[model samples]
Target: MSQEFESIWDAIEPTVGDALVMKVRFKIMSAIIRECRLWKVSRNIASKRLNIGVLRYDQLLACDIASFNIDELVVLSLKAGLDVRLEVQGA
Candidate 1:
């Protein structure tokens, strides 16, 4: 493999992963919002449940969730009364 190709892959891989994570996080946030409405819990309260600050929660709600890892999202989902499930398909 050429060095240029490897460099491109290195750049693209993380971008692709971040895009995927952002999409998943957006979906998770949608679900969390639904649960919050049903439970009549405010974002501030939800942030506390997730052990994060209200400001951070606001940023997350504003779609700045790329900074959070999958594990953090899983924990947030659980805190929002969601059950996280993982599925893997073999190549």
Candidate 2:
């Protein structure tokens, strides 16, 4: 038998809430990474622009989701000049 999941997080997370949080984090992280790439700057410069350390920037680039929290990712996105928005839907 096999199971199908809507997302990787859904499969790995023990609860729907946990999966939702991870999904949000991944979305924000992806936007930041996209902005960083569009800037065409070196890692050092990118880190400085985001006001985060190089290692942290590396983690973001590497998609290390567990290393970050929602608040931190939101701040990083703002620092990267990306607008963050929230949409709520009833389940």
Compare the candidates by lDDT and give the number of the best one.
2
Q: List, in order, the clash count of every candidate structure.
A: 0, 0
Give the alpha carbon lDDT tens digit for every residue of 1-91 in model 2.
Answer: 9999999999999999999999999999999999999999899999999999999999999999999999999999999999999988898
Candidates in order, TM-scores: namely: 0.61, 0.96
Residue 43 CA displacement from its true place in model 1, Å: 3.7
Model 1: per-residue Cα lDDT at residue 14: 61
**Candidate 2 ranges beyond 4 A from true positions:** none
All models: lDDT? 0.69, 0.96
- Kindly report which residue pairs in candidate 2 clash with one another: none
Q: Model 1: how far is 48 from its true place, Å?
A: 1.9
